[model samples]
Target: MPALQYWSFLVAIGVLVIAGGIFAGLTIGLMSLDETNLAILKLSGTVEEKAWAARIEPIRRNGHLLLVTLLLANTVINETLPVLMHSLKWDGYKAVLISTALIVVFGEIIPQAICARYGLQVGAFFAYPVRILIWVVYIIAYPIARLLDWILGHKHGVIYRRSELKELMALHGEDQEGPLTKDEVSVLRAVLELRDKSVLNVMTSLEHVFMLPLETKLDRPTMENIMKAGHSRVPIYASDRGCIIGVVLVKQLIINDPDDAIPLSDIKIRRLPRVTARIPLFEMLHVFEQGGSHMAVVYDSLPGQTEQPGESSRNGEALARIVQPTWTYASPRQADSSGGNVLGIVTLEDIIEELLGEEVRILGSTLRACVRVYMEITGRL
Candidate 1:
């Protein structure tokens, strides 16, 4: 009977100690999860993918509940662990030492190490139980959650802001297990900045863009440029750049009206969506998608204001630009907002490149190889 009593206390200590580890591990695992990937999975994924996203979503959103649960539960177990060992009829000092070692090793170091590297896995394993635990603890922790909401000014389902995301990426750049390459890290940084980058910086200025008036007779030069239009799409203006009506597909010149090419006025013209120059590229993408247009007219400011090309445009040239301009020329760099020139034109390709990483153009074939070799030698890549 005495042996059974001792063993029962021993079992109690073991269970409580291990439970503490799980709680601690859960805290680390959920905290370290990649909320971005989880969100993508939530938006467009299979059933299993969506399930995983659903399970993890709460852990990311209700961080307050989990932290409170872990803190309170771990604290109680750590404090009670020694007392239970003493009840096993052991020496008081020996019981204290044993409890401390178990809590520190099993409950802290082991869980932290495992969770830090394999957080998503650890989080998945505990998500179901932790979700229930959160609900159960909600009654107990509601005040704390409310206090945090008051302090943080809650926004639903927003795990991290853009600035916080940048800091976190930088913090993990030096991770030892599977460090990201410099290029990979830089691309990730650019991705976070997409929402901050305005359309003005990336759009093709109206001057550089190929456009023609509705009433123009296809003169020899216009015919030549249309026959060899360097771009896929060309904007057609009614009277001036300000009166841009719709775009023409270069392929349409050859493909339409086999007898004698359809006139520019008769070409199928999709409605061109208007985007403010100040709108972030990422936000503009949503508008583009919803509008089902690959290209949008970008304004320098707002409607009825000066809409001129941005200073950063590669094709900036100051002029009236009313001359039968070739594809090589852009609008005047100094045009005022009232003149009706668009700040630039944003294409789907430009936004895609900005999101994925822009390609760096290298001049001279030999120089490209030289730069590659220099990067390898200097480890500057």
Candidate 2:
């Protein structure tokens, strides 16, 4: 029994070493396979059919290689062990059973559990070596890949897709652990906003927008009134909302005489940046940053739509009677749909307030403690 136990222990060590080697080989081979697949894709044409074929062909070839290698290695190891044990005068069946059990326990299960626990760290440690192996395999596989391509009568080059890059970005976000920080979540949300949100979602509605009439003269009282309004800039429009002449800064008004008969056209900053309602907010942010402007105007819905009169009706008689223009800005179209034509305005302050509100709710206990500490430290009740 003691001798049997010693033999079993030795067999277990041998099995673990062999299994580790196999694992390392497969890991290296899989890395090579991935590189080859990418190369094939890179050399293929931009056409969808060609690209798909290029990508799939390499995967199929590598998968076949992997299956064959695993099968052959397992067969050789299992058969040779039994034969060697028989020659050594050990009971063939008992030796084979002991070796197989050891392999399963020590070689496969235990090592795999350890690797799984520290997979990312292990992968990072071997990253440089794995990369070198991939580069070497790519060069070696190039001729074979070309030959296969020729035989298949397929295209020889690949064009990378932007969708693949986007997928990589999403995969990165998914792999991160736990809940994302506020800023990280915001950045990720901002990225998604590029595709989903249009300029209309971020823009101030036409009703809420302040504009100067092209014919209006900038006199003392007019300038004073504009100054008192607390807006840094105002848009100048022609006869209607559609013809936006330009934007005028309040500081520019200060530079000119208050009583000067200044036509809005003379003070108007021409070629003001404009974005359609359908433009994405992420793209609009870039436009805003580039143009040094903080505001955008959202247009009203198309004209001539009538509304039914009811309590639930947004444009009902009750609302029409009760709603005052001074309460909010309204578009002409909104007035037709409801009693008013105004969509809600969202300012930077509004966004900041909303974020702060959410943060306060989430960190209620921390905030309470912080306040208490501050009050105690300052000797204030």
Candidate 3:
């Protein structure tokens, strides 16, 4: 067996190989982490991850510099290995083979494998030493780093688009060990899509919405019908179905004597906010939040859109019985004069349903479901 002339030379060879491995590992590992990954970790990562990110961030920020320093150190250490092997009483050809095997297996492949999987932790642990290496190699590495920066321009961090974020959420949902459940991912994806949707997508069409004629009386039967309708608020129309006046709260009508029936005009009618169908759901939500109104009339404002000539009916039946008005409470903001054909009605529940990716149930929703079933059975919807 070929033996080394001095054991001290063998120790020097081991040190060089280890140093080469560290340099190779740092190059692949630390460089993989870009600005955005670091930022996300700092903000939402686990405690250990946050600490690791904080340690690595400052060093990784200067991408070109860190890259050049690590690569240069690794190259130099690899070059010195064969020379050290030759000095240890090894023939030139055997030394070359030995050095190549050591560099490929220990210095490159093994270290790179470990670093790729646990880069953040590894990089953080070696951050201080890497900083010192950068300083030591600054004179040579600085020029090359500057040239790269000038050629490539500064690196801009990754910013995900709405669709990209949805894809990412889907990926997370696929991971069994991930924090988000499938339903949670679906809801989050819906939230990101809210800015793309409008009231037109969620509104109950005008012909399907329940309303009351302004002249309708709150007799015992009518009160019972209104309660059975299950709406917290009901729109009041005047002259015709197109002429929506305002809305009256179901709770407000409870104080009236059922025996002594009162007209809708006799009660306080709150103004219904109006919105264009083209407005995004997010903007519509902001409108509802600011105005403190749970309901709004969706309208089509496109020029030359003609009004369909028919009284609005729900599920092939008139929701409110038409009778001559004893009194009319006409607000200046009535729907008929609002410069658009009423398309439908949208409520807070509609937006919430969109966000939740499911239909929301309110008090009278069960009755509405039955009505939908009835309509479907009769083929009137």
Q: Which is the leading candidate under lDDT?
A: 3
Could you give candidate 1's per-residue lDDT for residues 177-231 as a string of tens digits?
Answer: 5568656777788888886787876888887877777654433345455544445
* Candidate 3 runs further than 4 Å off: 1-5, 302-336, 362-381
User: Which model, 2 or 3, shows the larger lDDT?
Assistant: 3
* Model 3 / residue 219 / CA error / Å: 1.9
- Model 2, range 293-339, lDDT digits (tens) per residue? 55444334323223222123233342222222112121121122222
RMSD of each: 12.1, 15.0, 9.5
Question: Judged by TM-score, which candidate is best?
Answer: 3
Give the range where candidate 3 is weakest over 10 consecutive residues by summed lDDT: 316-325
Alpha carbon lDDT of residue 211, candidate 2? Answer: 69
What's the TM-score of every candidate structure? Answer: 0.53, 0.50, 0.83
Stretches of candidate 2 off by over 4 Å are 1-75, 117-180, 219-230, 257-263, 273-275, 281-381
Give the TM-score ranking, best first. 3, 1, 2
The 10-residue segment of model 2 with minimum total lDDT is: 325-334
lDDT of 3 by residue, 36-117 (tens): 9999999999999999999999888889999999999999988888777777768878988889898899899999999998
